[model samples]
Target: MVEPPMAEKDTATMKPVGTTDPVGITVVVPSYNQGRFIDETLRSLLDQDYPNLEILVMDGGSTDDTVERLRAYGDRIQWVSEKDDGQTDAIAKGFARATKPWITWLNSDDVQCDRALWRVAETVAADPAVEVVVGGAHYMDADGSNPRPYPTIDVGPGADVRREVFEKGYMAQPSIFFRRDLYERVGGLDRALNFCMDYDLWARFAASGARFGKVDADISGNRWYETTKTAGQTLDLYAEILATQHRIFGAVSPYFVQAVSDHLYGRFHSKFYGDRGHLFFRWLYFKALWTVINARAPWYCVKGLFCQTIAKSGPIAGDRMTFKDWRDGFKAFLRHGREVRP
Candidate 1:
């Protein structure tokens, strides 16, 4: 594997000026052609007041100025810009090099909330048994305006995480913090998965009997953009999510099918099909959804369908929406065929 040379560790920027504290956390950022958001992403981490932190940046060598931009940090960050495998591979490489007990990987285009590390550290410090910590998240534009709270599932140590994750699919990666031991136990990420790799890892962790914890506050900012992986690879993401679901359940459950059908994105996809779907194809699509929901999930899994699968406020202008507008959007969504990224 090709590797870029490292710089002398910049103790002044990463640590708390000689304050004695635990080697609490390490964050790995993997990037390629993400120079625009890279600065904000680094600043979010550097601005944290936590005592001990070691951040590593693994770049999949961009043709852009990503390396030069990172060098501007002047050793505050330890980074290597070189051509390597895909995003998951870069992150898995980062995991191999990280030494801190707590580990999490942030995308180059994303940033954390103010002092996000402090909150995460406290949660982990309080409960050593908590292998994974999940906090809330927000969706902001590239310009960083119009912040909105993203509702996530509230799960605890004893919850049925495997079932919920398979059915609801609410585990957000940005706001999650996990221990190093757990990562090793679950065998880290599956590099083969382009999308939904985090979900796959989480399912494996649950399957390995790892307990989860929840933080009741927003810990990071997940920037929403047209170019982000999830946005550009919606169809692939759906397939990966289903693949993960099937891997855990041994078969695609009705609950899972219903979960997909009742989703806003799936609904839009359904409409997208309705506009262009051949008669037989349309029949197959609805029949597949209906067959699964009625056979395996209608009575059992869909009771909580409205809980996470569908947004309560509706997808467009979530609040202040009328039934007629909802009706029209549902119909027009198919006619106009707006692009949906998970």
Candidate 2:
């Protein structure tokens, strides 16, 4: 595997493009009615210690005070207010107007620290070969003081990078930066997808042989308490994302189908199956899981769902297991290292 780009560790003296600082980065913030938080978002970006940078805001026809807040920024941001598809579409439009080489986006409710841009710029400038640079991301609810560490993933160049991404989406959107070339190569964000567009874009990039670099520094502040669509319309958005994934990948794509199946079981089980799906429905759930896996890959399905059989024997009616049965079996295997041999 080729070595990924290395970023600067110390406060090295390097000249930034269009400035005497160090590096140039374009920060994009996409907003849709996040009125309460848009001011803070803009303030955070403007307060960045990085000297040479452009902040762009793309609004998707927000009806509330979001447009007013954006207007307050005036020429500070290369601002564009218009009707667009959704968050992903708004981001794509912002990227089209980006003039800088390094790019990253923060949600309207999210805020980057004053030094976040400077830290990211230093990292990217340290290594010329690094195609993508990602840093640590933490969650902030309302205020900026409290922080909760979020998972940060780095997919460096390798033969298995695509396989890993296709199997599991490991990176978060807010904590990422990469070259405009890489974005263009991966075909930018999918405008049709309201949510999970970032997932699809990352998968496409990884599949196309782009290398990822990691910085131990924190570069993003994610706000989880916002009324984001992922919080209100998870199931529907996931369904749309799954359909899009099938079209982009194939019907049998492991990542696409497995995620959809897991989500279906998760949402339904939590809503109805007993305390978490109903005892009777549990058996049907496993049977349905078996059916799905079998339809996708028979041998693989049988091997993976074998545990469902033992955990659902009490409420078993047919040749399948219930939701609780499958849950218990999976839990046992995960916690006790006990596998159901079939």
Candidate 3:
């Protein structure tokens, strides 16, 4: 491995890979004004168990302590502060400068598992044809407590992608590593999209007929704080996601049709028959259910029905759902069919 250049000057004590390996990996952290959380984010990357790694922190001209915090990290990370379009563009610039053949992005507020790079490297090493390796991820609080695992996408055995992955978003961007060549081949992320760039990129990659691999272990943690974009723009994000799917998979993709039906059902029930919060809750429930049902597998409609049942029973307090509740709701819906009230 031609040991990639170190981000910081003090690498005398750190283990360095000899210049003999065929592949090097880089982890890019695309940040904005995340001064309070960027330190923890970079720490997680620096603590990774994998050897022969590069850490690149690219910021979009932060006017806060984000730059000062980056400076504090010194040589541990290679960082740059300048204006850019957004996260996607920053990531592309980082990837272009990376000396590694494999890369993954770590959002400024997200943390990587201790074994993330190790697992991704192992997957890539095992399969020369694999263009992407995705693992599981969970959402956690800032202090690393209160974990809620993201839904898993079952891509099944083999190098090919199943329709279910695309339908249900099989690969979480933060939890996956990509081959540099494949990333470039797909034209990287869409700078135009503030949200759903991950979905768009994943769709493009899947459409290319590239090979994919799965690392069964959870390799990343996403934080769900109020400052996160998803918190403020749920409906907007949903619309972007729907639109992205239509554009990438074609307007008539089964996934689009399923989304439309689920959206209609939930929108009607929640907006007309229930409170505003309940409306959004129902939309998520039905969407998750739609994903499961459309997976073309039996017993997958549970996720969709799980949340809707709670909202139907009363008001929604927060965003949370369980499989058992969904299963029960699914059964109830099937039994009553259209006769049941929303």
Best by TM-score: 1
Candidate 1 segments exceeding 4 Å error:
1-23, 253-287, 290-342
Kindly indicate the candidate among 2 and 3 with the higher lDDT.
3
TM-scores for every predicted model: 0.74, 0.73, 0.72
Candidate 1 residue-wise lDDT, 1-342, digit = tens: 111112222465553333325446889999999888899999999886455677899999888888989999887879988888899999999989998899999999888884677767656656767888888889888888888887575576567876666546565688888999889887789999998889888878777877788877888888888988888876678678777766675544434443354453345655665533222232234345545534444544354333322233332212332345446555655554555533
Sorted on lDDT, best first, the list reads 1, 3, 2
lDDT of model 1 at position 67: 90
Instruction: State the lDDT of candidate 3 residue by residue for 1-342, as single tens digits.
Output: 223234222356454444334356898999999898898888877776456789999999999899998888777789999999888889888988998888888999999874677667667667767887878989888677899887666654753464654556645678978888898998887888887788788778788886778889888889987767877675677677766765665332334434444455556674665433443445455565455434543343343333232333322223334556556656655555556558
- Candidate 1 scores a C-alpha RMSD against the true structure in Å of 8.9
Q: Relative to the unseen true structure, what is the C-alpha lDDT of residue 129 in candidate 3, on a scale of 0 to 100? A: 78
Deviating ranges (above 4 Å) for candidate 2: 1-21, 142-146, 154-160, 244-273, 276-287, 293-342
Q: What's the lDDT for residue 110 in model 2?
A: 84
